[model samples]
Target chain A: EPEVTQTPSHQVTQMGQEVILRCVPISNHLYFYWYRQILGQKVEFLVSFYNNEISEKSEIFDDQFSVERPDGSNFTLKIRSTKLEDSAMYFCASNAEGDRYEQYFGPGTRLTVT
Target chain B: GESVGLHLPTLSVQEGDNSIINCAYSNSASDYFIWYKQESGKGPQFIIDIRSNMDKRQGQRVTVLLNKTVKHLSLQIAATQPGDSAVYFCAEIGAGGYNKLIFGAGTRLAVHP
Candidate 1:
């Protein structure tokens, strides 16, 4: 079965540095999303992207966060400046146009900021 | 604000026994619910889902029961095996434009042989 894949399974960056997390969602899916989970915390929604635009975002997705579909298969989340609190497991998910209820998730990128 | 929560934080069961995990949601507008299994160092894996229109659905050895009146959901695994040990989460998709999933605080399931 086709699954969503993410690059740089583990990323370590200095505080105040910019970082980009990349994901290749399942091909043929129309909607994409990004979520994060702090260690020992529930996963929180970050943002949703469709048609090359952001559909919705949470308070955690402030100005520092941006998502881009630079190519057909690549969906990336860029953090302008990393904070210690930003360190978490970032996950990318996608679903087909007709199946909005079932979103497939990638293995996730563990971001560690020091 | 909407929130999804699990009834228990951890459950331990003997192998070959049945396991049942429960969840409760405060969002009445949530039309769809999904159960996901997340093993250590892995992402959430889709187990099964049920729409608001249905009260029950079954897949493989797992069954999902939804109680719209109480805003509750439960996942039942029959003849649980050692491999069934993992953290289970319940998520919901509210009625809206983007179908972003709102996940619950996960319940850890441990199966002892």
Candidate 2:
């Protein structure tokens, strides 16, 4: 079965540095999303992207965060300046246009900021 | 604020037994619900989902029951095996233009052999 895949399974960066988490969602899926989970916390929605634009975003998705679909298959999340609290497991998900309710998640990129 | 929450934080059951995990949602506008299983170091795997128009749905060895009046959802696994051990989360998609998932605090399921 086709599944969502993410790059740099584990990422470590300095507190003030930048990091980009990349994901390649299921090829035919139209909607893409990014979510994060702090250790021992529930997953929180970050943003949703469709048609090369952001559909919705949470308060945590402030100016420091941005998402891009630079290519047909690549969806990326970039953090301009990482904070200690920014360390968490970032997951990328996608669903087909016909089934918007069932989003499939990638293995996730573990972001560690020191 | 609307939120999804689990009834239990952890549940331990013997192998070959049945397991039922429960969830409650405060959002009446949520039209869809899903259950996901996450093993350690992996992402959430889709188990099954039910739409608000229906009260019950079944897939493989699992069944999902939704109570729209109480806003309750439950996932039942029959003849649970050791591999069934994982953290389960109930998620919802509210009625909106953007269908972003809202997850509940997960419930850890442990199966003892």
Clashes of each: 0, 0
TM-score to native of every candidate shown? 0.98, 0.98
Model 1, runs deviating above 4 Å = none
Which 10-residue window of candidate 1 chain B scores lowest in summed lDDT? B93-102
**Residues A1-114, model 2: lDDT tens digits:** 999999999999999999999999999999999999999888899999999999999999999999999999999999999999999999999999998888999999999999
Best by DockQ: 2
Task: Kindly report which residue stretches of model 2 are placed more than 4 angstroms away from their true locations once superposed.
Answer: none
DockQ of 1: 0.87
Scoring the B chain of model 2 against the true B chain gives a TM-score of 0.97
Q: Is the docking of candidate 2 incorrect, acceptable, medium or high quality?
A: high
- Evaluating just chain A, the predictions reach TM-scores of 0.99, 0.99
Model 1, B6-46: lDDT tens per residue?
99999999999999999999998888899999999888989
TM per candidate, chain B:
0.97, 0.97
Q: For residues B1-113, write the lDDT of model 2, one tens digit per residue.
A: 77999999999999999999999999998888999999999999899999999999999999999999999999999999999999999999854578888999999999999
User: For candidate 1, what's the RMSD?
Assistant: 0.9
